[model samples]
Target: MSIIRSERRNRYTTISNTVFTNNQLSFQAMGMLSYILSKPDNWSVSPAQLITVTKNTAKKTARDGVYAILKELKDTGFVGIEKLSTGDTNYIVYDTPIAKKPNPYNTDMGDPNTAKPDPYKPDPSEPTLIKTDIKQELKSNNKDLLSSKHDDTNPSDKNSDSAKQVIQHLNAVTGSKFQCCKSNINHINGRLNDGYTVEDLCLVITQKQIEWGSDGKMAQYIRPSTLFKASKFSGYLQAAKITKLNPDNRPVTLADFDDLTWGKDLGL
Candidate 1:
């Protein structure tokens, strides 16, 4: 069976298929998560509000059902509850289940105003780098790449040095002339700011060249725009890492085979 999708240009939520395939979550929980994600980052709803919207708010059975779904969401790591001193509760919803301890203070979950100070931001207080989870890392990278805000650290002279090095490596492996222009720097800096080491970037370029270098059509994608894209970089890195682990997967060139003295051992 195939699923048809509408072309959503604006106000659409991007969710991973992992949520749907998650056997641990019920259909009701999935629906609730979709509804929560569809709203603005600052949008919040209370348990009482949900119960009140139910068929019979005055009945205990209806309230219990609401509470059960909420509990399931919480236990499954889709939501974290924070009770404020002012007696208002905030729900911290995540696109993916929490892998680490849920920091209630974390404001990256759909909030425009991030309460937690992110070092990856363009104008970080210090010239230091702080590694973050993949979700926050991707968000920071996208913001740095898209926004017009340029600082000394993120999209500045200091940042271009590393991006140049990455571009140089790409050129070295792919034999292509790619300069550290705005577009190239933006994509390279995005990955750099995401805590990917220089070695990681080099490995990705080297591996992609080996995989795509032979085919003329595929070789065109060896450019910075394709290699360092946000959606494709991590996956390429993972694949490159696997190739590094298994050296046997490397291409067997003409050097790998030796000319044999045929029938030398045969008593002809």
Candidate 2:
């Protein structure tokens, strides 16, 4: 069956809290649920289709990995799988409730068995309306104000928060006395906005600290100003990954560090 697009404009899916709380579920399983929920309700999908979609979105692309995630999602009651009458075809179906268009005239009045009220009948108990337009305008303005206050964070604030987190992680890992400064914050925020996650930054820092913590020449360069500079931050990320894969191996020469601009070349 074809998927239906309703009135929702954001184009997002809902993931319930239980999915996170379930110890049996992994991150891959949660991602699969999100993909399923994004489709229209009652839509049928096969195990092969799920595996393909999961492979595209997640890092764990093994067939057994996909099967394990699907099994977990199924066992948790997040999705249902059924075998058709043909007995050869199996379809996985999302079990969540779907949204239906609201009707103004057909009010259920909280009881499904209740009879519909006459539209022609005027109720005298209804409250009298006065200055409704002005009241509605005021309410709308208040709502807009509240939305502005709560919905979005200032870009500067986001940058500062991300920078602070990076700095905190660095201090914890390197045993350094580095404080947040305008220059380092801008550099850290720039890398973060370039699509590197906070965890990625921390991993880079942790790997570098382990590599350079003892060397007097390199230890001095572990400060925020030297490591987090925009021109060299990407190189440090690559270097960290290299170090993680080969902890004991070191670059052959100092020139090797100069050629470590892989992150810069990728525009990371």
Candidate 3:
């Protein structure tokens, strides 16, 4: 239920441009894009879920058609695809501008039905030139500026390390191995930003492990995606507190009864 806010202006521009100018996308692709944009931000949906939700509305029945649309969106930079550890794909559609190559054929000075410009034809206008050193300096300055912007947007090393620590703690407490990947770190950081402390997260993990560790059926469900989710973290914290006060016998081991023997040792 983690929702990322979508930019209204960017969404409108992307949809409008795709419908009116792109002319390459099919009706199915356009419909799929529209459907994805209509979803809440940061909403992760598998391909099967997407097909089920969009098939009726898009009037497309084939799963392959839906997959083709998704692939097109990914290739065209309209959406991002994250493959989860569970062998399912998560699609993230953003309201950002997609990069496109400049079309020399679609120029303001040309008619749609007219032929393309001749390579040998000389233009009547005079050409203006810039000095080489100034151009090089400008290019270097632009590169430096872009680098700074990229650094500002990327997650810092401290945040990444903190996320890794959380993953390690979970692995230790639950006796399960989980790697710290970008998607996992992103989820953990997002929960942290939402006011959940690292202590609260670890408490939840330990509590769940104690409760479900002994049960073979529930042990498989102990994963980062389930225990560290944004929407469910608060609930888990509350449950953990309740379980702590009552104390479940499921966590008990044979070591707890090593002192006890037969009736003779029990003062019989």
Candidate 4:
């Protein structure tokens, strides 16, 4: 590869070369970190504003995309996010990536799959237990099969009403304008046919809204194609179940973030 280098005499920003070599950082994360470092100290910009300025280089820039890049930098110790008392967030860029604390989880524990399994010795008294478990599983499967038949036999009018209710709940929580159109109704009906109740779909909507509503970047994903996706709906429904079990775990208000503790731990 041929390379050209330009020598700058003035109006330049100085940054560490380690950023370019860091395997932990993505190209987007590195570039965004460099851009933030180039700005004068105390220069503040929100993710939404940063998206506007980065349009030429990143045609698909959005609040969520910008937040992701910034998050990457923060995770790698190149930046820190501080939510100020004034309700504005501040990004603190490091000249060099900060040293990360040692991860206890990274320590090699012998491979789990290599561990020997316990020798199975059949318990004479356990036949009843095994039969009971098998009967319970079969009973559950039969119930599901019967429910699927019931759904298939339900009138179209009833299904339409159910779909409308689900969409109405989604719209109410996410501030979306989705209608009970054919496409949206089909998505809802598919989940319903899978033995999920309208309440289950509404629970998924409410749980996701609580998670993504205030998050500008994630807010855009609260749509029919994503929420009611066959591959994703079950996982979302499972999360909703978890949230319901611990209702108090929900975030009720905005709180300041602790980068040293939380940022590095954030998953991509």
After superposition, the stretches of candidate 2 with alpha carbons farther than 4 Å from their true spots are 1-156, 246-268
| Clashing pairs in model 2, backbone N/Cα/C closer than 3 A | none
List per-prediction Cα lDDT, in the order shown: 0.58, 0.51, 0.52, 0.59
Candidate 1 whole-model C-alpha lDDT, 0 to 1: 0.58
TM-score of each: 0.36, 0.33, 0.34, 0.37
Best by TM-score: 4
Show model 1 residue runs off by greater than 4 Å: 1-155, 250-268
Error of 3 at 263 (Å): 32
| Number of clashes found in candidate 3 | 1
Ranking by TM-score: 4, 1, 3, 2
Writing each residue's lDDT as its tens digit, candidate 3 over 1-268 gives 8999676765353345644336656676677677666656654443433433432333533334455566666656666655445322345675553664454654556455336432123244833121223223323333222112222223565565556556655653443446666666677888778887766666676567656654558867677777888778889989876765673222211111111121121111
Each candidate's number of clashing pairs is: 1, 0, 1, 1
Q: Estimate the TM-score for candidate 3.
A: 0.34
Kindly provide the TM-score of model 1 when superposed on the true structure, using C-alpha atoms: 0.36
Question: Compared with the true structure, what per-residue lDDT tens digits does model 4 show for residues 62-148?
Answer: 434566677677678887666555323466788688875555666556665534421122235652111112223223333222112
- Residue-level error in angstroms, candidate 3, position 228: 1.5
